[model samples]
Target: MVGRGGVLRRTGGAVVLGTSLLGRLRRRDPGDAILRRAARLTLVASVVFFGCRYGAGSSTLATYGLFGTIAAGSFAQLPGPARRRARILVQSLPVVWALIAVGSLLAWSTWAAAGGMLVVGFVVAFAGVGNPRLVGLASAFQLFYILASFPPYQPGTLPERLGGVTLAVALLAAAEVFLWPDPVPVSYRQRLAEAADGIAAFLDATAGRLTDPHAAAVDRDTRRERAHDAVTAIELNRSPPASAPTAAGAQDRALRICAAALREVLAEADRLAADAPAEPIPDLAAARLLSSCADTTRAAGRSLSPGAPAVAAADLDGAVGRAEAAYPVGAGNARDAPDVPRLCRDATALALADQVRVFAVGCRVATGARLVGDDASSGLFEYARHSPWTLYWWQFRSHLAPRSAHLHSSLRLAVALAIARVAAGVLQLTHGFWVLLATLTVLRTSAADTRTALRPAVLGTIVGAVVSGGVMLLVDELIVYAIVLPVTMLLAFGVGRLLGPVWQQALFTVLLTVVFAQLGPEGWRLAEARLVDVLLGTVIGVLAGVAMWPRGAGHDLRYNAARYLAANADAVDQTVQAVLGAVPPPEGALDRVRRRMVLIDSSYCQYHSERHDPHRQQLNWDAVLSAGHHVLPGAESLLRRNPPGCLAGWPEAAALLRDSAGRLRSAYDTLAEEATHGGTAARPPVSTRCVDQLDRIRPLLGEADLESVRHLVEVDRWLAGLADSLTRISPPAADELVGHRRKP
Candidate 1:
């Protein structure tokens, strides 16, 4: 019912309202404010230009164009490094994009153009976006959209249309830098600091819970969550460019080191359960000391300059001493005691080592020393760049399991896309195209950015589409069409300026759909038909994603725990062999140990993601991993001290080591419960088995070289101390068992 003037007024009013609202919302942060104002201004400017070009059929396009420009411009506000990189990317992207657009234009067929756009989207999403998998998902939907609504070819027309789109994108990208400018570029350092804070807090809380056996599980779970966050933060910088390569590399190393330390802690906790005393130690001074160390580490993160000194040595010594007190001489070796405390201690030590390393790294950064490569030569450096196979297995092994949705896996995304496409075809629902849009909206939503992108995309699409429909309804003349062309340019500019890249795509889609719907042979009454197609695409996308879980990140916690146990078993075998006079550890043995460790780390990491798991698998896995540290070293020490008849009771030592391995394996089996409710109540008969093994080995060590034997005993004592430290960490569910479940 609206006339040309009425529609123009509505658009003008929208511009004014959007601008005003953007200004109010800009107050959240200076960066946000600048971006919003730029977006608003760009939208308004586009409207003015469109109004001058043609009576206003291009108003919607103008708005969307501004949105894209503003969104792109906002990348400039990221932090210096991020902004600089984005600039390079934006500048470089246009050249490639232009080439592709030209190719599509030359092809001139609707399917070709559509397919090209979809392909471009896929490439950009994969290579350009933060995560490559997301690119595949977005590309899949785009493909559907293009297939469903390929423009009918006209002679020599594809090039012109493609040229327009390319030009618009180029202009929008430029506007992102010049008009809507991001105040700060994203900073890897900031992310690292945040991650450190999470880890520090976790360690502090866990340390506080040492004395309270009842609070052990709670502390373990909480720490796991924090550690997971820290690792993710580190992963955020995985794809750093050359600008801050040293920093980026260091950050990566620091994160890995932290993860490794945490793993050691988990292993220690497991050992601690076997060595625990009957009555819980009420005085938690040791726990408090650890908490202090955590606080110091966090406090140090606030000033993230490199080359920072480690936490004061005196404080470190004091904390270590306090933690050591938790493992009384008899506590771990007690006949019926669980080894929880010693495991807790070991996990704490690993955490402390990480904290110290982080402190050192901060000092180095602060002092302008380029962080070095993670090699053996870099003494005490825990910041290795590459993760071990252990971490990798821990990360991907779970994908082997069947699940409805793999939240972070690419396979799930591909399957989802395929399903959505098939479903759309079967439904024969043109109006359901919005379903694809909805799927995109859902796909992008996460704990970090929430739904900020999806909301704008959906809104921009509707606005652009409705405006195109209204334009067709009002003016069907060739003159009107000619006038609308320049107006379209301005609208594209506005959308480019405002909504950003993701929303810009949506805006582009809406504009294209509207233009075709209006100029086609079909009348305005069929507008619903176009909308239906859009909806169908969106629906297909959602259904595809929901049907086959890609990452399978939603499994029960017990599976993750079991994986952790398996990793520990492998680590134990390797560590023992290495310590038992196996120099350089037989080809693949050392590599296997490291690989298993990484797997454990990754498994624990999954627990912290936004996926579905009722029992907090990450926490349980951390505990299990922490527990491994204690048992592994103990098994290794037994071999080292009793190496091939060097000691009076060398055979006894070997037998004892075997017994320990068996006990650990048994405990691993018991803790194999992936689900919260599946844990077995059976305990390991640790003392009886250990005594029998010791009795058998005693004759082999019958005082042949008493002096040499004494030296070996000293080694054993030191090793036991280390093992005892590990044992203070976790209460083994059974006295004799260790929960190692990996198959040899």
Candidate 2:
């Protein structure tokens, strides 16, 4: 199989699996900046650590300096230009000092330390909601706090500790900027713009094929895969540590929604390509509409970046107006003959246009367009338009509830650390921090994730401990130990998480062993203590993960996802009723969808990150989640395309939509109900009812205006999309899954 780096790959599965870590390392690509960054980190560590121990003549300073350096360097997965990373580290000086000081004071007794961990852990983890950069810095802050908290109540030595950390932060910050500086990172906005360009190109190509007789066919699957890749790139890079909040946070946040909107456009375009009618679209106006959509996206792509030309909101509106006018009068053509395939083509084309409209609105909002009259006037930023801190504060405040996965994770970490601290203190473990360290590192958002990571980590730690112990016995010279320390730091910090957590944990254990040994006279018992404390931490972490999810997390995520599904179904009913002139479309539909999307994104992140058990019954979560994402967008698109009183003349067509929506909504309701009550959902019955509704619409299309026809098609397609997705979920899948037993 082809492997990473495209080096040392083997043909057979067995041979490839049999390859060693050494072999893998040999084939590994040590990127230009990473190794230099690691080397720079090593140099800083050596200076701070040895300079403190030998020159200053205090082991406390040495200990804090060494760990502080490590924490500053390795704790966070902060991505960006090196200068940006450096800026974040420099800005962290106050936080680092505060944590260290508080932790030292808390070390007065076991009771204090454990209690402090509860408050400190939650606060640290919870801070991530405001700014994602804090998420990475969280472990570092906690590590520093834990480093200070677990001790012989050495509050007097707090200055030495704080001084060491300050020195380390300064050195690391300098190293990040001046030494081995990282190349400027491509902005996620640029990536989103690029994705927009690709999707737009696909739309253009598809439209040409639809309108022109000689145009070549394009493959839908290839376009879908392309769009999928684009989405992955955007999603992965979008939240990379943001710089100091100016309007930057607000601007960046707007881009994020824009990215989401573009993602929908890609998804819709993919479906449009696949569902294109065999016969060329009879109405060239529909083809022209699709072409206009492509133009809209291209304009969006050009204008998304900060320096790009400012695009007026009216430009987009005018494009839509022109496309609307292009539609031929439906009088003579629709009077005699009913064209079902042609109507379906028109619907598919309109679906693309609807998604494009959403993207257009999103783009305008992102570009700071504040003049669309009503919905687009205040835009997505709304009240927080000028104030980024307000936005950050609100984001933080929103997740305070128990229902939020962010809160759950914060609580989970806090509780786990508190328990671990108490256990370490009561047991009188020599290296008490090791117990907390193990728990902090091993525990994840859920128990299942912890379980997945625990086995390999435990194995790797045991092996590393044995090797470390042997080194301690064999190497008596302090000179040798000092020399090896920087080398180990280089390998551990410089190299990426080598071959998952196994090598990572093992190498880290070894690296720490070297650092600790250099600081003191230790024997094999230190290694033995390390192993014991680590084992204790892992058990507590697993318990904590499970506790938070079902009180462990698996159950909570499913229920959360199910609630979104059920809500989307309700939204479907609302939009359909609104279309039928029964009532205005429900307000806050977008807000509800946005909240659900956020919850699912956070809750299932851990689940999606791990490899699933292929043999077991698992829900088609991707399908369910996609259906959830589409619901609000579909609602908005339907309502936007159909104005008030438009459906008054087409009562039969409106009824057709309402009836079909009832069946579609019922399927989702069943799935959601089953998902909430238990893990299993019975297979939703396939219905001919949608086809019957289409039959009802066929006669109406003959006499309806192009506007009416397009709206009718959009309504049908929206429900049809939901039905197709929901029907794919069955009892055979996710039957043994957990549902939230403790309802929030």
Candidate 3:
């Protein structure tokens, strides 16, 4: 035996190594370090405790059931208040112990235990079920997981085995709460902040191009969308339990106040854009000011907390102040200089008064000092009465499309899992069943890539199997149990960080398999079989994902671009209308304009990402998008200054404005035709068209509209100039079209 000094040295060295490793993890991300340490500690303690009671091979069936129950619960819940309730239930229930106790008393068969599990699984899946559209889908998946566990090998008493499943859930529930809990509940304030920031960034980037009429219209549409999203977030947060204390409770109250202020601001901006006469406007100081206010509002969003309501309040105050400071008045005069300033001053005061009124109302409700009228709060009724079911199934609605994609994929995945399990049983690979599950879980990308995702799945499984195999060698039961827990925790954390879904799942599966590896040689033999099952499942899942009603990244790229451009067109009209009508734009119009630009930015970023993507299975819309980039910014800049319909009467401004609009429309048509026919030859003559439009508007340079339309004209001029840069291809070579150069 080694000397005591030698043992001490080895123990000291191990401590140093552990400390160094933990320090490294901490440096990577403090949050992750905390999570890993907590997870590891819990796993170690639980494994040791459970091992002492149940021994090496007893709880395999229980563990499996537990995993499935947790999966069903996680997948079924709607990730809000319900998720919290589910967590509490899972933690408090001692479900595994109860199931096993009942099973022992009843002496149920393996299949009977499995049948009972199916019922329990369904109940968990359907618990607190709201949103009917999602219910069927959740139930279907629950069935699949239940069936996947079937036909493997019946545990001694089904009830006893099922009890272990409950135990597994209890462990997970405890992990969730005592481990790093999610800090903030989803709240209106958070949503408002995110939406506001996105719009503000979009506006700043594309502000220079705001003068172009179509671009202005697009900006307006995008802004409206942001407003909608912000409103929705607020509404969701305020639903029932509105006064309950949570992380963002104060922030939610502040967001409600800010949302009202934002709405008023949006209307004002619109009026300004709508009322300006048809002149060649140059500066966009007013629009920029409003955008700055939005930026301030977004900044307030970052500091959301009940204790610091001042951050959000200050933002709302700033937005009101900026709006007051920015609104126009007559030029200063000896007799009336200060009076004109009073007009804006009064407007600012009015906005502040409204904000205070709403705040007091919400405060009364929050503090239980008094109740506020129903009308005092915004977006309350809008969210409560809205049918999410109708919303989910409404295929005609563009906003709802993302949900459909999610639903379709979920169902197909369920079907694939069910089929894979059945195949696994036939192949005699029980562990392979989990390997297949791991593979399915790990595969990423919009479309399933068998080749790319397959490697990780196979590698993870083989590695996990090998690891489990080695751990079995150190079979002094307590030592085996003790070492496995910490190692599994370490492996899980490391793999989760280092790998994508497949590798992560593989790691998780491997850890789980280690826990189950103590089962008789039959279970060990089933490990190889599991690989075959996984391979088969992966094949089925990928095929299902691709076979029917499939969507790829390419189609979305074009749709997003088109939709964004369409919104831009609307924003341009709003701004132009403001200019030509010789009226002050409505409050909040600029906010709407800025929101539209954000959507275009999102589309552009998406397009850029997809263009160079290694997954080249989809159509590349990058070329058209690139051409589009050359045009939109310049257009948006012009619209910002000119405010489409409200421009001052400069010489050729209107004609120039009209001409640019035509060119954009033509370009859009050309792109549509090219996309349809698979060629660019059908595109219109953008250069000649742009040049002609500019020349027509050039004559108005001497007029006041010329000065008013400056921003818009400059943008139009830039677009025309860029269109000239692109080589234009005439379809049928003109001569060929005339049947003179060549015979058809």
Q: Per-candidate RMSD vs. true structure?
A: 12.0, 7.1, 13.9
Q: Please write out the lDDT profile of model 3 over residues 212-308, one tens digit for every residue.
A: 4345657666765675455434322133222212111222323343444343333333323332323323443334444454455455445443454
How do the predictions measure up, each by TM-score?
0.51, 0.82, 0.52
| Local accuracy by lDDT, each model | 0.42, 0.69, 0.41
Q: What are the runs in model 1 whose C-alpha is more than 4 Å off?
A: 1-82, 91-149, 153-188, 191-527, 555-561, 577-590, 596-672, 675-744
TM-score of 3: 0.52
Q: Kindly list the per-residue Cα lDDT of model 2 for residues 1-744, writing each as its tens digit.
A: 356535444345446665664566545634555567678888999999999988998899899998898888877656668887889999988998999999999898999999999999999988877676676688898999999998778778989999999999999899888877877767766777788877877777777666554456545346556766776566521233332111223454556556556665665565555545455645565667777787888787778777777555465456556655543344225455534445555555555565565566666666666534543432343533445587677667666766777788788899999999999999999899998888887787655567777886688789789988898888778888788887888877655354556767777888888888767776667788889999999888888877765333345557787878877877788777777788776666656766665555455543433334445445655455556545665666557667655676787787788888888877877777766665554564443232444565677765676557656766777777667657656543243233311100
Superposed by TM-score, candidate 3 places the C-alpha of residue 628 at a distance from the truth, in angstroms, of 15
Per-residue lDDT, model 2, residue 363, is 63
Residue-wise C-alpha lDDT for candidate 1, range 1-744, written one tens digit per residue = 569889999999999999886665454344554345445434543443344224444533443333233333332222253335345434543443454344434334433443444444444333312221222223332422332232233334434333333344455445445665545644555555566576666665555455665666666677667666555434311323321212112343344344334344333333333333344566654455556656656655555534444333345545645644443433234343333333334433433443344343543433334545422221223323334444234333433444211224434333444444344445654433344344444442122222333344445556555755676677667555544543453344343434454445444554454444433455454455555554554444444444544223324334555655555555554444444443333324334434444434443333333333223222233344445443433343334333533433355554555555455555555465422334344232333122232343345444434333333333333334333333332432232121111000
Candidate 3 Cα errors over 4 Å, as ranges: 1-31, 34-61, 64-149, 152-167, 179-404, 425-432, 448-451, 467-486, 493-510, 541-554, 567-654, 666-744
Best by lDDT: 2
Determine the backbone clash count of candidate 2: 11
